[model samples]
Target chain A: MTLLQRLAGSARREPRGTLRVVDPNPLNWLYITYNTVEEPVRVTRRGKVRPAAMSSYRWRGSRTMEIRVRPGGRFADGTSLDACSVHRSFTEQTRWHSPHPPGTHFNIDPRTRAEVVDERTVRLHLPEPDGLVLGKLRATHVMSERFWRDLGFGYARDETGEGHW
Target chain B: MIDAPGPWASGPFTLVEGRSIISTEPVVTDGEDRTWLQTEDRSPTVRLRANPHYWDRVRGPRVREVEFRNDVDRRRALDLVCDTVGEVDIVTEVPHREAERVRRSRHARLVAVDSVRALAGAIDRGVDGLPLDDVRARRALNLAVDRSALVRDLFGGHARPLAGLTPPTPLTALHRAPGRLRPYPYDPSRAARLWQAAGGGSRPLRLAAMTDWEAVAHAVAAQWHTVLGLAVEVRILRSDEEQREARRRQAAKEPRDWDVLLLEQGSQSADVPPLELHRAFVGRSGEFRAGPVDPKFERLFDHLRSRRSQLWQVLAANRLDRYVTDQALALFLVAPRVLYAVNERVDFQPYATTFELADTSVRRGHWSLR
Candidate 1:
């Protein structure tokens, strides 16, 4: 199949083959296989974001959130996407500067602290109550530990070491 | 692949041959210079093969291989898809002028969706020698221009006139009650009266717009000139560098060269959280704001952000929308739709937000090459 796109000069930077989950953020291109949770259980025709990855989430208090991860999820590298890995991913995003693009954040509030509660649960402690955290998390793409070790904070470049991975 | 460790894509498809061009340049931010490496895919075509290890391999990527052509001209691309001979399965961004042709074509169908995008003129209330600082003057300007005419003439009736900063999307429709939020009707006499009372028209209003918006800007300038008898000058920002420079100046609070800047504002998704749009266009540090920050607006926005319940948040957002509209903070124009030309042989369903082809498949009997 052949697809034709008339992209702007700036938009032509990224590969066009990737399936961007129809979301508000144009860069939210986290492939379904790379997600720590399941593909969204349901995305409304109107484009509403529903639970997919984390089975359910609740605000423990004003500043704390408890999220239950869907069990048995794995990264492309074949590593289990358990609660500890989710915590680690959140912590890493807060500690390191994103190499993807300027002005684009990891969507994790830097002031939040991630703690693993159990095998399938993680708790986030935010400095202040943020209602938009869940929406932000939807935009945050989780990468495998191997991805971090190999690519560091920088994007994965092509064979010629040019384009983003 | 030559030597890279991995592309390790977990998506429905994996990159088969990825080629691109890169350029590193220095950009200044906050008085400090930093190196920015930019990459451009100079390759005319990129091929992707279905990933066998994909999570839902059974239901995902029915087509084994997908090829994307990046260098096709917009008009020619539409024509190719509409051709009797199937040149391409799907061609996106069907030009508005050629939409009727695509509609009349038997080989292709036009898919149009109300996108989460809106074009508006950002009024610089703080600019010197401009009377836009007065709310009455701003309201006068908004009332002067005919949004319906712009939608019909410029957009070929593919857009809806905006009543507020946000477009009429499904999410926004929930918040805005009919008749509660009405677009400012074109009233040149009332506009002239308000302009005269506010002591406007002392100097020509300078309008700055990018090349893509040059035509709309000129049309608007002409309207303002004829309606309010206000002298207006339209300046086109021809290059990206020029736009960046203009934005830098706006961010630094330096003397602005233009009184009104025409720009598009919207989320990439069909369902956008109203708070996101507010922060990007109405917040004090908003990227597209040409007007001075209003403390009152910020307070309301902060209140909206603090709400936990979705209903309360939406109510607060509606209040903010009403406040902006009443104050005439920006000249809200039209909500444009995303158009696509898909071949008849392909069963393609267009998403309102992004250009997605993951579920796209050819018709039952059209898979084989003729």
Candidate 2:
């Protein structure tokens, strides 16, 4: 092989692990990964929310949301992910941890309540119906409940400082 | 609670951060055993390998790794591609001035496509004591801008003048009425008439613009000055972050800081999610950035976002564009062409949304070393 070809060959390994991405624009500090495709959501390319983690979702009169978590979905740490986790994720993200400044961006109403309906189902009780409810749910990054509880209010930490979920 | 620490990731590649990441050796992911290496030179050369576990074997890990070198100094990157690099697969965001030179280079092939990027100046009607609050004053400013000259002179034929916020792609072009295809042409006499009618000459106008496009902003200001004797003040923002901060301040209960703010906005799609556009213009749910909502604009935005059918959404978008333009809520600038250089050998697939790298993937096994 030619030198360039050999250099390429040497870099290759089984289950090849290299995809370098870059952007000249500096990331927003508030939402560091906002607008970046780093976070994958349960949404199809057609802008419809799908059941990657949730088996199904439906709106009740445009105000209440019922989402069914898919069974057998596990977190990176091998814990089973369920409806309570999803509820916690949405409640925390939209209320306390949103990057938007108060009154500036569209925020989920504070009156909204995410309650665990069952082991695999969660129900969101909204004060009023919102058309962009699906879109709002898609933007939420569901975190592992165990890890979230352990870490408290800060980010998940790794020994090497190189890991984030 | 909502964010993550840097050292952990779920994607195929683990980031090794530095002034630039240099991946001279391969590393495997946690548990997946997917081997990949991402390295960068200090000047910013990014080399990436595809995961053998997930990548389409028939299409690519095409050869091995894809190397990208980014430099704000385009000339240096151009030199690397033209003179020193051996079959470097791709180069992106090339300025139009360098297109001809790069086209002549034997080492790479240049491809130019229409970009989704559009430019517009959002007039802050909420700012107190500003003539921009009057539609006639806003119209005078919009009429004064010679968009054709700005595109030709500032962008060096790299852009097309925009009539609306959405780039005139197949998806978004229909949202604008046929007559609205071109923004109001340079009409000094008409602009003067509007300025006079709006009582425009008494006070100076303050304009907030992005630093990169400050020259264009200045030129527009100069046109208004000459045509209508309007004294315009310009404040330049260094980046989008600054503009967002300004918008946030504007959205507050306090009075807005400036009369006109020039900003760039890009959409994920043309209009699939009309709610985003709705929230942006009318300050629906308190997301108002245009500074002071016009009652008509607010009504149209609500009507547009409320529609469940895509057909109605498209129709509403058309009406919205015409109304916004006529009201002079925003002055549409040029939509730049996305350009890139690629090695003739690589079977590269370029997506229109260059900002999202995951969307642009090469076909597997389509590349061979000569």
Candidate 3:
């Protein structure tokens, strides 16, 4: 198995993480609050207009990814878009980044384990952490790394080459 | 989807130039003396004199004959070199052991530089070198390493093991590791204390790893579990799936659901900025590299990304050291070199350092046809 498989999952094993299914055609102004499991996802905002606070924005904290069923929708920043949404989003910095130098150690308060109890069954435990951070989850979404490496491509950085290795 | 020709396939050496069958008579130029056959090996072995009609004044190959035996086979290559039948030169990819052996026993010349990724430690090529921020923690971890053991066991001492990556080209300021980046060894006790201080004992770390890195991840996990008594589970992400996750993170076009990724970045080139690393974890990368977040670093990162103000960009990149040191989201292990073994008659330099070997030419006067 390769590093990618370890990050996602080996082919032999089942994948862990939440899964979700959204309507293919979400209505304009669709406010999605799904569980991404992890906190703060990267986003490209609606209507090509750039975000004023572009880099400082956090997907989880605010409206990250917004699309328009109707182009030229009204934006939070009072910008106009085509009848469809534009692509611009906010990015959030992690809590563990240190401002020192390269090769310095930045550590995370890792949440290592979770289990499924029932149909929609899920219980998460992050020992000694503060606050309940809600996130989006999509079971139907996660891809198996092993499946692909075995299938080819996306193996690891070292595994990359011209044609399929 | 890619019918477009690549650099090597389209020019100088065309892909269509390859022979379909070994026995097929090769296409010949008007003034060339050698009539040749394309031997299934893709490379052609020909005995050619100077083309009288050639426009260039340059003399051709030194040797009268040139032989290509498909891909060079190692043992057979060595024997050919040893016997001096059709070979007098050979290059070994394994630097320390094989190069040393060839030099001593086989009497082959040896030149060692970084040739391939080392067996000394695991390399995580992710954008976020965050988790490795704390000099003490990083050093402590390095101290716990058994470099000699890894070198001996995994590579049979063919690699010169070190705590960090050796830049392929001449030293630029970027290649140097600050005094704080020193390595740690296998000290369970120190790891325990560091873990306790870093809140490792306080929570469970969802240890993300790729299948290739599973053994190393488990080893670290075992150390964490045993020494620090920290609860951790090692999760393996497949390769392609991880790439899909990375592409999603990069494009900001898709969603991610992992805690951390054990992966390598595409490049360290300034042109290849560390933005991807920033986005991989803490940024809105589907929370793949989620957080126990740091606001100061985040603020600087924000400034760095937005402050197209030239003076500020340098400050931001410099600040990168800070951001990476504090949180330790992604850890960079080590960078290795590419290893290749060639037949004695094959003359080649460690092709230029860019990692692209397509158009690399062999050193003159060294290569000969068998």
Candidate 4:
């Protein structure tokens, strides 16, 4: 609701629902919606969302920062957020993780992701909820940690050009 | 629907009397009163006044010269109507706010008939069948599309938008929530899992789409990278070639041939199994790719083959919505609407669905110049 409240929200967790969950503010709402390997493939989320769920760090709620990364290359479920995962999101998707560098016009807060509780469960957390905030998230980007590492920290000078950022 | 327009040289008065386009001034003498028609013109504007030398159907009076001036600027023209420039009538291209303004004006009456058209999630071309075997991946793709923006921008808050392919037509049966509607509007992490579950991973998806809609295709490709972590290859082809390729993939009935196609075809035009089947299932030779199906889509397909009633078709369309959205054939974007504004006196019927050619025939004779 206010600047102070928004900053305070990042220190909290998120909630889930059955059938469907219309997220009020999905941008910073750190959460996950996964399916159980079990039959019916019912949607599941983190047992308890944590504000600092798995983020390596955080910004002052509004300013963008740079998260320097290197390549781990290989990616699979258990693949650590290495050079490869981070690189792809950067080079391929033209994004970064954790604190995205300056001029990052669009990106999912790289500092965002869920820690796997098991083969099925993944927890979530968020910064805050606002109509304008989440509404703008409709046009943001989400890249894996591996993508950033591979890309290092290159930024797109001109998005119109078809080149690696 | 048809484009037979002119100052209608054959109607009344002659264009020879006017000097410029969008701005025409004509002198009219009805024995009781005289008025001059002067205004800027553009956007399908032409005026029709009393025909003096001609003879035609009469509302009350018989013969006089009709002035047809193009008041392409809706506001100024509408203002003239509000001010009543001596029976200066017929204004098409009336703004949304002025839709009521003209109605309230003493100079003219409004003939409104919800002519707004919604152009939501339309596939540029229709495919014959499900391109992928994975229903989850299909749902993921549908969810990745931005339907709310379309609802907000296209309809101007005048209509309800659905996130299903078949939308909420009377014929629709299956319905699903717009999972992941906003915030992270296009979820690639979830999409990756769905793709993997649907027999993918390792390599990126080659999302197929026409080149004309480059932005939409790019958005899909970017989302694929995040969700499925796949390198999506967007391809563009001519409309006819695109149709040929898409139908071939749909008809091939093989998942290996095509992964996904971000289409833009008219979604809510018609509802019937025969119509859909002819296009998606039992399509023309070499026009489909999603190969054979279970007894379900087949049975449903068969039921749609018959000519159903309008009410039946509406219900069927709603049912088809579930099939397409769930089956991943189409994700309802927005129930898009077309936008246009005309002068105040232009009481011609507005047709958002069909071509807006009759916007030309808004003459004083047919137009009630109140």
Candidate 5:
């Protein structure tokens, strides 16, 4: 299959199929093909957010959310996806510079921390009570630890001319 | 221009290096070659192959490889898609003017979907000596134009009259109750009466718009001129630089040259939730706001943002939508449908938000290598 874009412009510098997923460019179409993440919630066709990667989630308190990941998920690199990986991905995403506008930055807020409670559970500690936290987590993508080690941050191309995560 | 490599993240198709190529010419190849053809002026084409390690093996990517090409001219893009030989499988956007042509093409099919996008006029209420400062006058402006006629005549019935800032999508319908939130009916007499009550004079309103919105601006100007007997000068911003400068001026509240700015709203993905759409349009720091912020709207928005319950937030959003319409913050126009030209051979399903080909496949017997 072949796709055509009407406009001609420079490709974005942000690595494709990563945590930074706010912009709706053609590159975004490739996000699902390359990255794996337990979206805390998925927006339905009618625009309602329902549980996706996570089997279930609930608010522990005003600023804390306990999420239970669905079992049997794996990254493209063949690594098992669990609570610790989710915590690491969320933490790393917070530290990365976001190219999107502040309002559209859906990654866990920088002040928020991700805590792994068990193998399948992760707790998100937001700085303030947010009604849209689950919706916000939809933009966050989880990559294998090996991906971070190999690609590090930002756009990286090895001698083979392949993009890093 | 870095190419996507394989196996970094988990998608259905990994970026196949070497086999994946970018070229200016329409070269269809499944050979493993490291050919990267790029020219100074032409947009490059990209190709991707399916991932063997894809988790859902049963469903399958189905196709072995996919290619993407960028066409600088939309007309040419449409032409290629409608070609009898099927040079291209799908084209992302078909210009509204050429939608009819695509519809008539035997080799191509026109996929028109309801877009979240809306075309509206941002009134500069802070501009002194204008009746737009008055909410009744603003409402009068919205009421004066015939949105239905605009859709029929201008869009060829390819659009829906916008009742508020957001388009009438299923998501938006959840908040806006029927009859409670409806578009201001076309009533030129009522508009004239309101304008007269607001002490509106013969001051010629200056309307600024981009090249794309020139037609709508002119039609709106004509309507205002005929209905309220108000002369409107439509200034066309031809270049991106000029549009950027106009936006900067609008933001700084400097150079009060234009009383209204005719522009498109929701250029972002159509899948955006109604709450986020509201934040993007009327929030204190909204990107599309061209005039002075309203304190009432600010308070309402702040409340909506602070709420923790989804139900409360939805209700608040409904209230906010109603408030913006009632206050007539902007002249709501039509929600145009997104158009796509797809080759007959491609089994493509258009996404409401973005142009996606991930789930798309070719009909078994119909698709053949050129």
Candidate 6:
């Protein structure tokens, strides 16, 4: 299995495993590992961005993409994950400065709204047609709207200091 | 958010930050019997301990705990890691001189990858009294240094001499099609002529660089002093805030202190090359420090924004690369290869660049001790 698959599987099977790693401090670990809860449209490995939570996504034209979420997804909070939640997560991402650097956004600022076509379908709207949309999309992670509204913009830590969706 | 302290983490492991250092602990308790603990020693040494909570998927960091030491001195670091008592598992940032020795040694494994960033110097045309206001002087400065020799001696032949902004990597080479690119040749006599024409004979030049890159400052200072017979002194910027302030001062067309500044630009794949250019050269906040602006280059970037074809986009980027080089906006320098050393006992896979691992590569948790 790929390291990511193993990590995601580990997160599912056991929320705690002592896996020691040398920290490179390159990208945010939150977005990089453990994709069982909130997953990005794609994850990069060895320079290639591979699809993950998103089954298939394509640009409608230059500035918009029709995104299809994998069926039967659930947030760790036991809340059903849907297209509206994905749209809300990304819209929240652009509002405040994300932990990611400015150039990381590639000027693909999602404004106005991402149309929730259906329960499993989302249409992302970009400011303009950006050539870098694919790479930037790889960095955008979905967050639970319930968590974002109740606890705060970031992940909530349980009593044990464990992060919850 | 720009002001957010940390990104909401959703991973198998969670970071435990200490007063001075940060450590990671697994969040998912699989009833595994293994643990991972780390403590920092203020400087470079990081002590790793096997937690009883750690569940090992891979075998053996045989020693109960391993110490990782960081030393700028390559030979000394190698010696410590090779020692039985020290038991240093890894050495970060080894110097180029010890690459051969580290490669041959059985104690430590040498880890070197081409640095995604390049070290280059930019001349400030906005400096009130500096002769660099003339494009010829900037061109003269670019021609004076022998980048090939600098790469050979300073980098131990482990870097590629960049003529333009983009290094010819598998991804960046797309922006550097053959025949369209030209780097300033090392020609001191012609440089001398340009200097004389620009009336810059014996003028004192101040070069500013990052404090972390003192070695780069000295190397550039030495090259300019020896090659062009110009008096050059290097100044180190204490922090990023200071660097930004200086860039802002230059962007606002305010008088600047130094004539040349050593700057670094990195490309981590995707369509980032154009964005980098837009940040450094085109916008109102663009910080090249050179007061001059080119309308033609700005037009090219606008063209870059509208184009969708990979072939056409790369062609436009290459044109921008050529335009920037010909203007002597920044003298292209060699992209140094990143170097690391790990003990022979450990199983590790190092990455080409650090930023690439932020989302995908597993640098931790999966590595096993042999």
lDDT tens readout by residue for model 3, B318-358: 55544553434334343333344443334334421212111
In model 5, the clashing pairs are A1-B67, A2-B67, A33-B11, A34-B9, A34-B10, A34-B11
The CA lDDT at B16 in model 2 is 28
DockQ of each: 0.15, 0.11, 0.01, 0.01, 0.15, 0.16
TM-score of each candidate's B chain against the true B chain: 0.86, 0.74, 0.51, 0.49, 0.84, 0.71
Q: Weakest 10 consecutive residues, lDDT, candidate 2 chain B?
A: B29-38
* Model 2: native contacts recovered, as a fraction: 0.04
Residue pairs with backbone overlap in model 1: A37-A53, A156-A165
lDDT of each: 0.62, 0.54, 0.31, 0.33, 0.62, 0.53
Query: Per-residue lDDT tens digits of candidate 6, residues B45-65?
Result: 333332222222231112233
lDDT of 5 at A115: 87
- Count of clashing residue pairs in every prediction: 2, 24, 118, 117, 6, 19
Model 4 Cα lDDT, one tens digit per residue, B16-44? 23222212122211121111222322223
Docking class of 2: incorrect
Interface C-alpha RMSD per candidate, 1 decimal? 10.2, 11.8, 27.9, 31.6, 13.1, 12.0
DockQ score of the complex predicted as candidate 3: 0.01
Best first by lDDT, ranked: 1, 5, 2, 6, 4, 3
Query: Which 10-residue span in candidate 2 chain A carries the lowest summed lDDT?
Result: A28-37
Among incorrect, acceptable, medium and high, the docking class of model 6 is incorrect
Evaluate model 3: give its TM-score: 0.41
TM-score to native of every candidate shown: 0.82, 0.68, 0.41, 0.38, 0.80, 0.71
Candidate 3 chain B weakest lDDT stretch, 10 residues: B1-10
DockQ of candidate 1? 0.15
Residue B266, model 1, lDDT: 56
Candidate 5: list runs displaced more than 4 Å. Answer: A1-52, A96-98, A101-108, A150-165, B1-6, B17-43, B52-62, B248-257, B267-274, B307-309
Candidate number 1, chain A TM-score: 0.63
Q: Return whichever of 3 and 5 wins on DockQ.
A: 5
